[model samples]
Target: MKKVSFLLSASALSAIAVPALAQDVVFKPVVEARLRYETVDQAGPAPLTSSRDANAVTMRLRAGGEISKGPFAFLAEGEGTLAIDEDYNSGVNGKTLYPIVADPENVELNRLQLQYRTKPLIVTVGRQRINLDDQRFVGSVAWRQNEQTFDAVRVEYMGVKNLKVDVTYAISARTIWGIDGGKFGSANRPTQIDGDDVFANVSYKTKLGTLTGFAYLVDEDEAVVALRRNSSQTYGARFVGALPFTKKVKLSYLASYARQSDYATNPVHYSADYVAAELGLDVAAFKLTGGYELLGSDAGATGIAGGFAFQTPFATLHKFNGWADKFLATPGTGIQDYYAGIGYTVPKIGKAGPLVASFTFHHFSSDRLSIHYGDEYNAQVTMKLNKHLSALIKYADYERKGIASFTGDADTKKFWAQIDYAL
Candidate 1:
């Protein structure tokens, strides 16, 4: 019977090729790398250094991948770095070293992106990382080992379930390490052309928490409005809950007011006002935070000045406050900031992992409408020897009182130890 009709058509083509190879469409790839070491010590006045020392080493790499079929999906990533030994115009007795580690085997290109999701819509476009709200002034600086990436196009919406919405627009920005790394210079480079930033947020959630409202706009191009006219327009509101006398201890509050006119093209057309507040505590693994900020002055504005403010895209932004960064440009007698911090997470020494710590203190003054004021201290420690290795250490110190000659009472110290691995 013709060999049983060719074995029943080869068993119906092997059951339709085993469900089309189980509905094939799978892709996965990823990579990561890191190495770091640092040291610095400096001291005040004559002979340029109550003391001095420096040593550095750094390396990084990353790779990406992802793809799916059912609801459709895709993703991408990239990274690079190198900064071994370090020697960019070395100085010991002449004092000419402030992160000018020129040729530590330089390499760039931090991130590349592409994403899509459906179910309330989610979209992302090339060169990513942007953080709004509570970032305190824009973000994505990523603590530098080469970060800060944006070439944007982002959109997000959550149908309804406590209401959520997000929007982002940016054409270019790729600044990470090198603008004179560390203390950033080249006039604080970060204004890649075709600039645009617009953020709109609306949120509502209850059970005694979550409320947000925001509007922020940034438009620049003319060399970033001739070096930070900061292209103004801002409005804000934020509130977080769970402290009706303690629901495990949690509280948050923020208020913002901005009115900067003359379009700020930098020929000194002044108008300014800003205010801030924050408080938080968690109590289980222990955490505490505090904040107070104010900037207001414009009576004969010659070029509007302010204080303790200049996040300018963040990522471990020097833990915020003055050392010799010369107040990061903002002084028209406008500035004041008081800060506090504490954090701890231990609970896991038996498995050889778990230990974290933090400490911060800052007090800067100046708003007799903006010159400069100073006091700062910061510390951090981290340890986790499992799930891909980890270790870190950090420190910073600064002090200067009474407009201390452009604020450089010149007492600084920095040190870091690092180890990280993941795949």
Candidate 2:
């Protein structure tokens, strides 16, 4: 309560100061809302619940504004979420009888930060959002009802043309769960995680592509017992670019590699590697893509028995692996994924707007144990109703395969419908 009061007071003072300074200032207000319905069904033999189906209807709202003057700005935002159908385990809701649906009901401050921006340099401080290239290592986790944020300081230097440097030092990570999710250091999913985390990135652009080098050192402060095992250091590089074959055709590609090892006070002493490559071809309004990703394992290492695969606990897990979310946590034997997809953008229809439809398939396997986990099929369609409104329909099906004892996930299916509005 006191912190919220302080943020309000600060904003009021800033609004008054801007007029007194007699400078050119701009204030932009923001409002957004989303309503969604999701359902899930899985075959027998799941761990958390005896029930095989779940239904969840959720709504979220965000309200805030930005106050800015030349090279200086202050932003404050608040977010809230409501659940109409709670027939599912929200991780923090204690509804263990139904399948897991992560979005919970709660409210809290979202973002409050101050920034200084100029031609070749930008600095930001306070609770903010930091999403690096592709968001593979560090991201905002925006797909969830409550997005993740960081209480930290960030700096960017771009004095050299086609070259950029970015760095950040964060003290705490505000998780996707809301106020009802419990405090930091909780055994379950905590609302906050205290840590000494750092991220650094340097990128240069060329005719062929853009090349980037980065290092992420995450330290889940020992006080957070549930997350201590996630502490690690990762160093990686990435290349992404596109080539124009003609006026109507283009080729796009991305390749990334990262190495990870235990860091800070983490009890685990092991190392793993990550590799990913994706290619896409676009001709006119149609697109096709294929990719492979490997979350390497440390099995049979010096002192480790089962082994741990490369983990990206803070990443937007939903965007990778598969939409079925079966691989949110990498298996002990590690995992490999080969996927392909096709998409099309339809021309505007009447006053409705453009429509986009896509379908993807994924084949999953173990990196070391030679186990075929399963295969997943995903389909999605999105339509823009107007400028401020849109709708989405999506579905996913994952069929369990291989030895049932070795693979834990059951045959699962999920469906979703959503409506969004922004202003």
Candidate 3:
């Protein structure tokens, strides 16, 4: 309660400060609402079978204004959540015996920042979102009901055309999902880490294609420090452009390699490497994509390991191969995944928005060639009701091909319907 009070007070005071300079300040209020229904058929291992069928509602209200007179600007946003249907936990094998105190009604601040923008340079400090090139490993985790936001200081320079640079330093992480929520971990010992990460990227365009190079550095704290020892770094490049074959067809590709050393948060001192590549083609109303990834692992290594696969903490994360979430932590043996998919947009109906649909198939294997593999199928559909409203539904299934791990081979199914409105 005290923390929330402090934040609200701070926001009010910050807003008042802008008018002192006699600059005409403009305040814009922002608001958004979302309602979701989800059903989980199975979760976790036996003796603790878990599943949930519940309805969740989230709301966000924000008031921010600009100090039009100067190069300074400020913004603040807050959000809260609510859950309906108290008996929903029964779907998880009678695990809802206790009173539900953690149901989404908790209110929290999402973003509060002050910025200074000038020709060629821009600086921002406060709670915000940090997303860089594809958001593979480092991202804001925005798929959940509440989006994960970072508290940091960032700067950018764009003095030259076709060339841009950015840097960010974080002091804390205000995760959208509750610390004790299953989305993160057990309530008994919720994990929270404080640290800093830096990222830089440079891009150039030519007649044939555009090339981009990026690097990242992440330093961990004590609690999360074990996840990445002193620090971790990544370097990679990407090229995307249209094909010379024809004017109606387009092609794109991405390739990256990362090396991990003792800087990893684990106690074990080991090094790993990752390689990933993807190819995509666009023609008419349909799009096709395929990709391959290989994560390196030493057979003798112990502890949670790293992989080269593209890690998206958001974007319907469960759609990826392997178990929906069983491999979120990644195994030391490493992994290899081959995937392909197609996407198309259906023609719009009279007075209705267009329908978007996609299907993807993925095959997963161990980089060490030890265990058998598995595969998954994912499909989803989405439609927009209007400029500010949209709806979505998705499904995913994973099947074991050979050997299986504790993650389970038993088929799992999930269904979700959601409506979002923004202003």
Candidate 4:
């Protein structure tokens, strides 16, 4: 009887042990490295020798890993950049002789997060990358070596078919410019409150398109007094969809509108509006697009110069305006941008998977005063060397025009060459 009892006990132990071992956690590694050379040449300053053209070569490296079991996972990442040529002013380092090169040398934590996901819900906590609505309002700023991240908790619910809801409450916005009061030494560099912000979005899909409504509320609390006064509330809606004109050709459109007003501790009491429209056509590997965007101004027009104008301080401003980045901040008179572009892709070229090229042109003007901001042209070529490797070359040129009511438009030229490896 004793032997039989022992045999049963052994069988039960094996059954439990096997299931426990199957639940072990597994880790996946994430690695990326890039080498880039950037050059900027500009003309038309009041003092010809105020700043010289800049040239710099830089490298970025990042590594991280994710561990997961069932519905729970954890991630940690580290990032660093090294400059081969320090001739350019990195917005830090005090090299004022050269034009600005925003890519500074630094090492810091990139992402660290805990996540839980189920069939209908997903939640993430800690510092992470967030991109919303084409990244117009917020994005990781991946072009820079030190990408931006957010220290916040995000939640998404998708239980209702065709409808989804997402929300984020962030205490801090980690910027690509790196941490403040540190090496770079700026209060808002590593963090931005956007006056204690909250973002909420809801979306529903239909045969016509996907429609989304959003609200972004910001309190006034920035390191810069002028910036702090920029605190406001924005409510908007967006629609994006594709129309199948034929089996081989398709048309796409995006339309958005928003209204902004002072909120929280902001002293500004003016109201402004925002509008955007775009249309595109796609056939095979070729694409063509045209777009127009406007940011309404308040007579009180652009605050930069003291006018009340619509502003998106927390937006991924680089993606819009133009490649020269002359309009990083909207002028006090408000702004309007008209643009067009074309792109093509060739597949299976020799050992490389594909090659892609694109060119775009933009015209800038003030919405309030009808002042011509300038004109810019941009072009890029990209090649996929392998599944995890790619190369790119990009160029941009901006023609002089009257901007900010200044003496004249500053003609600017820029070029970039980059190689990336990812896994």
Top candidate, metric lDDT: 2
Which pairs of residues have clashing backbones in candidate 3?
Answer: 51-92, 81-104, 226-265, 227-265, 228-264, 228-265, 229-264, 229-265
What is the lDDT ranking, best to worst?
A: 2, 4, 3, 1
Residue by residue across 281-307, what tens digits does model 1's lDDT show?
Answer: 777788888887765546565544432
Candidate 2 Cα errors over 4 Å, as ranges: 1-20, 46-49, 182-186, 222-224, 301-304, 404-408
Ranking 1 against 2 by lDDT, winner: 2
Error of 3 at 265 (Å): 5.4
CA-only RMSD, every prediction: 24.3, 2.8, 4.9, 9.0
Winner on TM-score between 2 and 4 is 2
lDDT of 2 at 74: 84
Q: For residues 30-123, could you state the per-residue lDDT of candidate 4 as single tens digits?
A: 8999999999887775653337789989999999988777777677799988999877877666676776677888788888777778989998
Steric clashes per prediction: 11, 0, 8, 12
Off by over 4 Å in 3: 1-16, 43-70, 86-105, 179-192, 224-231, 244-247, 264-266, 302-323, 406-410
- Worst 10-residue stretch by lDDT in candidate 2? 1-10
lDDT of each: 0.57, 0.84, 0.59, 0.78
* Cα shift from native, residue 173, model 1 (Å): 22
> Best-fitting candidate, measured by TM-score?
2
